[model samples]
Target: MRHFSVFGAAAFACALFAGSASATQEPQAADILFERPQLEKLKGGDRLDYSYSFKSADPSLFGPAFDDRIGLRVEPGDGPDKKKVEVEMFSAERRRAAGPFEDMSGNPLLSLMLEENLQRLAAIFQANPRYMKTAIRLALRNAKATPEPSEGFGDAPGWRVEVAPFKDDPHKARMHGLDTLTYRFRVSEAAPGEITEIAISARDAKGDVLFEETTRYAGKH
Candidate 1:
């Protein structure tokens, strides 16, 4: 009902992997959605991590479901006056992600978390991640977040924003039947990263789930 702000750590994507991206403008929410003071709220000696899970209705088509973690390390800011964060998302790649971040004064982990998902979808569609990213940007631009219980680790008051960017896409025919895909984001100040949980899924004509992925707060670990 009201607006709010959120993160979880991240890496750059070609430009998306390394450059910056942004969403709709709503105040507290967009800040949490894209920019946040998590780094400012946090300090040296503070770290945060989230549980990452991937599940696709058809593993053979979309890979297998697995568990992972996204971690953030508070360190000296890239500039003289602020604190910066380093992210270790995929251990194999040893990637460090922060989206649309020009500097490291604030939390960029949330940006990373979201970009990661877009990258995955891009890969599935054999399209550019940036192309898929546009959907989210459009969704956030027209979004009206709904009030909800800060689920997962954040029990504080929160908001959930849901969008189906592909629902009306004229290019739906080429999306591997995933044109109905939807994304749900839950965020609150009570959580360590402000992000409570994120869910992405798409169903088939039969109403069976086709794919699903989620990132949730698992508490300090």
Candidate 2:
């Protein structure tokens, strides 16, 4: 049997909806662009993987190379049974100083600029969709999600995923820097394999909403 991830099935459904009329519409910047999720069945259990790309409406004002910050939250089951899971998909820390600068050893301004440049490079690296995808895959692979017995409910599946936070650095700092964001996923045997709802939201460091979208899942299972 051919198995698919929630995102993969969703993409297929989207493609079907994109009839000839869609071809005529000009491409515009979307708040979020997500790739189909890939499902992997292992000896232990099943895994789902997905990634997204986003473009802020005001990127230039945010930062020279700033991209949209994406967030993912997964809740399994209905209100009573629902459990919110936190997935750490991105780092929240700024870049740090590069290796020791030999030529410009004494100069402070050059050294500061060098550090900033390194931070920019790091930002670009993290922003790369490919890099982010690979990182997510690796994280899932290394995760030890061993199911444990649930309280009051016989043997229930429960897995824990540990994600390391970004390292704290003293040197690197930028004005109006982008807030670090994280992503996570959740699955419940009781809930349908399909995602029931999808939400996209953007916020500043102060917790102000910049953009938000909440809707029922349009993708197929």
Candidate 3:
């Protein structure tokens, strides 16, 4: 499962969509990205084009309290705007990990492998479109809160995720000799297309932010 806990915590959401006009609603987190028209063409097992950038971590944050910036880029399947998008690019950054892990940097080979693995993951994600729905479903199953119903548009209401510090290492202090850690994300409402807002946390599991930051979507093309 390749760290399903971390992936689940980070990749929760990204599977909701609705074209029907409604009212003002809250946004939900997503594991995949897609445009309105692209979502329409989905058959239960269709793949989607997806791209995203992770926020570079500032060494200063040095803890689960540090903010993790994440961006999602989705290309529609086949429609008038199949190549276009509703939100175009959705970006957000929030704290995810509070403590430091074994920085494989000490080993040049391992560091290189990390980079290669990341690229491999990207290639696999793009080649296999079914990953979109699979990622979202996995995230939802791991979320602490249940998904909320949507009212209208904007930020589809009904999704929230909460994270607790690690039981063995509450402060996430590598100095404290921490072991494995796990956090939780609760779903309140689900944003269909773009992730309008997210309030997830990272810690030793004590509900503390070694780093934290909130971001907004600029609807950038």
Tell me how far the alpha carbon of residue 53 in candidate 1 is from the true structure, in angstroms, after superposition.
0.8
Q: Is candidate 2 or candidate 3 better by TM-score?
A: 3
Instruction: Give the runs in model 1 whose Cα sits over 4 Å from its true position.
Output: 1-32, 78-81, 92-102, 152-155
lDDT of 3 by residue, 68-135 (tens): 23322334334432332212112234222221112111101111222222233345334232442343
Clashes of each: 18, 5, 39
Estimate, for each residue in 1-221, the C-alpha lDDT of model 1 and write its tens digit: 11111222322222222223344354433444555554555556566777788887888888888878877676666665466665666555434444323346545644565666666666666886566666666666566668778755435688787889888888888887678888888877777657778888888888788888787866643
The parts of candidate 2 lying over 4 Å away from their true place are 1-127, 138-179, 194-202, 211-221
Error at 1, model 2, angstroms: 30
* Distance from true location, Cα of 104 in model 2, Å: 55
User: What local lDDT score does residue 156 receive in model 1, on the 0 to 100 scale?
Assistant: 69
Question: Which runs of model 3 end up more than 4 angstroms from their true locations?
Answer: 1-74, 78-144, 147-156, 168-194, 203-208, 215-221
Cα-lDDT of candidate 3: 0.28
Model number with the top TM-score: 1
Q: Over all chains combined, what TM-score does candidate 3 have?
A: 0.32
Worst 10 residues of 3 by lDDT: 103-112
Q: Write the per-residue lDDT of candidate 2 for residues 144-184, one digit (tens) a residue.
A: 33333332223544322332212121211431222232222
lDDT of 3 at 129: 24
Q: In candidate 1, residue 108 scores what lDDT? A: 60
The clash number for model 2 is 5
